[model samples]
Target: MSAHPENRAGLWVALASFVLWGLMPLYWHLLKVVPSLQIVAHRVIWSTLLVVAWLLWKQGRGWLRAALAQPRAAWMLALSGALIGFNWSLYIWAVNAGHVVESSLGYFINPLLNVVLGVAFLHERLRRAQWIAVALATAGVIWLTVQFGQPPWIAICLALSFALYGLLRKLVAIDAVGGLGVESVYLFLPALAVMVWGEAQGAGGFLPLGGAPGWGLGVDLLLVFGGALTALPLIGFAFAVRRVPLSVVGLLQYIAPTLQFLTGVFVFHEAFDRDRLIGFVFIWIGLAIFAIDGALRARRTGVTPVAAASEA
Candidate 1:
């Protein structure tokens, strides 16, 4: 069957967002010379500027006032902001530290972890297939830990943090962009402080100043653009969600991590030995089961999955 024009456009937008997210490691890799903390701080600072400017243009200054009017919402968003900030910091650090492959695994595990969180915190019941999927993914982590003599803590932390962030966002009443703007406001001062401290301490990477050998103009441009990059995909996701079916969006979510995994192996030349492959295979099978079950359930019920688009 032919899809409507809006639906088609939504699909394309969603793909673009996921592709951008999938290829984000390359962008971060370009800033590998900068400290991860600085990169993240810049991200926060510039993202706040861009997002706040956008909000002003789109909805006016009243949006922020309205958001802050609700004290509970403000506090919840503050907590969610911290979680996403930590996720961003860890992800950038992982990419530069030769752990891109492990980082990708975290995102691959994220959806499943979301399901588990729903069950644990929301008191939602999981379907049999979901239980199997979670069990298999758990086994995969265990296998990876036993084989490597250490857990894939990078991946685990990423998945857990993002899942919790998603959970908090779900509870908040504000729209995604508004919530993000609030979070950015919460983070703006701290991030700016970090940037100032780095420069004062002669460790900044933005410009040739304070005795630090700066990365040059190209790096500076990338850092400035990082804010737009962070917000663009989110805007795209928001647009796409209104037009696309939730089930399809859920399926499309895999694109980003899959691309990240490929980038890790092909671009960065990260090692993926047989031992790691076995563990990933288990997770893959679990994810396949989870996707298939969700699809079948949606089809049978004549309803789409009711999930909020995550900012992770």
Candidate 2:
């Protein structure tokens, strides 16, 4: 049977968000000549301005006041913001430093990490398939570590930081946009400080300064629009998670990592030796098990996997 129109729309929106996320390496790669920290500062500064404007238009000043009125929520969001900021910087650095494959591996492991976090902190019970999936993913990490002769710190950090951020957000009861606005507020000062420091040190290139390689009108535009680029997919994702089954959303999340892996291997031509490929194969096996199990449970219970697929 055909699906409901709204469901179709939600699915499309979710797909778009993942696709954008998948292709983000290309965007960051353009600024490879620029400092990753500078890119991050621009991202935070402009994103704060844009998202706050959106909150003002949609929610007005009262919402901001309301969010700030709660001390615990404020602190939690501050922590989450720091985590995301670090994650963004690391991912940008990875993409530019020829670690896109490692960064993508982090994302590929994120959902499983989320599952582990849920079980540990939220006291949630996991099924047999979930246990196996987690086991397989753990094996992948071990294999990768053995093959690389060092732990994949980049991947581990990204997965853990983002997983924690998602966990905190799940605990908060606020609109996604408003929460992000508040988090950005917490992040804004530090980002601005970094920008100022960079400028003082003659390292800032947000604008053209005597024809620096990565400094020009084009770079300025990309840096300014980085905020929108960061916010749009998130906005789409928030809309999508609410409208679609979490299982479907969970399935779609792979699109981003898959695209990143392809870009790393095919487009950028990053090294992917057999050992590394074997490691990723294990992770893929785990993800397959996780997805299939969630789908079956969703079918049997006749309920959306919204709660189950919080692996996002």
Candidate 3:
């Protein structure tokens, strides 16, 4: 409500990001004909191409050379690509494994992990409320682990991978689409390799996308859409980055995961027992404290709302 046009754009981008991510289960579901690995490979390959096209369109022919001229920059972006690839592959794998709900938990916990990352990587001092929030959330997760008598691996991996990915993205100043495009090149080779290998071994690539091998029209569409779908939120997020602050972006990271949680539980019918419930409660409390405290501090200091863009 307090958003300016620019700020509103950022919020819209964040919203778009969450909406697309929340609805991804439906997207992936349509791709049942595609192997998870193949689908992910396509995601890498095609998204790279799309990013490249966008970059070339925006900057003309010199973008790649300029980026490569700064090998350090190129490597950083390439590393970011790898990190995101891990994240994308893990997410696709998790979703296909009937672990979207658990993946939701991972994303929900990601904000807290971001906070931890900030403390570790950025030397940010936590407010008392923020500290309490972290403690509560930690307790909740510990309780869940104890309840399960095993690590919440799916949830933990998702949270950690994303947290690290966000950290890497922050180290650069590239536009989201451009940055992703650059990074896509890093994963392009591996993705292509996988596709070639799949076809060679007769593991069935994009061709068998339906009944027996292929996933069908819907799946093929999804694979293509995946590239566009990825590009959209990223552009939105890039808009937000210019409009917002890092701390604010951190607060906004909750949106996508929150939707994922609901989709996982009520819509997808994932089980949530007493411990898991309690864990979520603590996490919610932690996030609330963290957000409110950060907002107030940032407001006093006239910091922009950057947390929302942290997802990049």
Which candidate leads in lDDT?
1
Lowest lDDT 10-residue stretch of candidate 3 = 207-216
Whole-model alpha-carbon lDDT for candidate 3: 0.76
Q: Which regions of candidate 1 are displaced past 4 Å?
A: 209-211, 304-312
RMSD of 1: 2.0
Ranking of models by TM-score: 1, 2, 3
- Give the residue spans of candidate 2 off by over 4 A: 208-214, 305-312
- Compute the lDDT for candidate 1: 0.90
What lDDT tens digits, residue by residue, belong to model 3 across residues 1-312? 335887777666766776787778767766765678888888887777888888899899988777666536777777777778888888888877778777888887787788899999999887778779889888878988888898788888878987887787777765567677778887889998997777666665465532235545666667877878777777776776666675657676677777777777777687877778887888788888878887787777766455444434
Clashes of 3: 21
Best by TM-score: 1
TM-score of each: 0.96, 0.94, 0.89
Tens-digit lDDT track of model 2 for 265-294: 999999999999899999999999999998
Ten-residue region with minimum lDDT total, candidate 1: 303-312
lDDT of each: 0.90, 0.88, 0.76
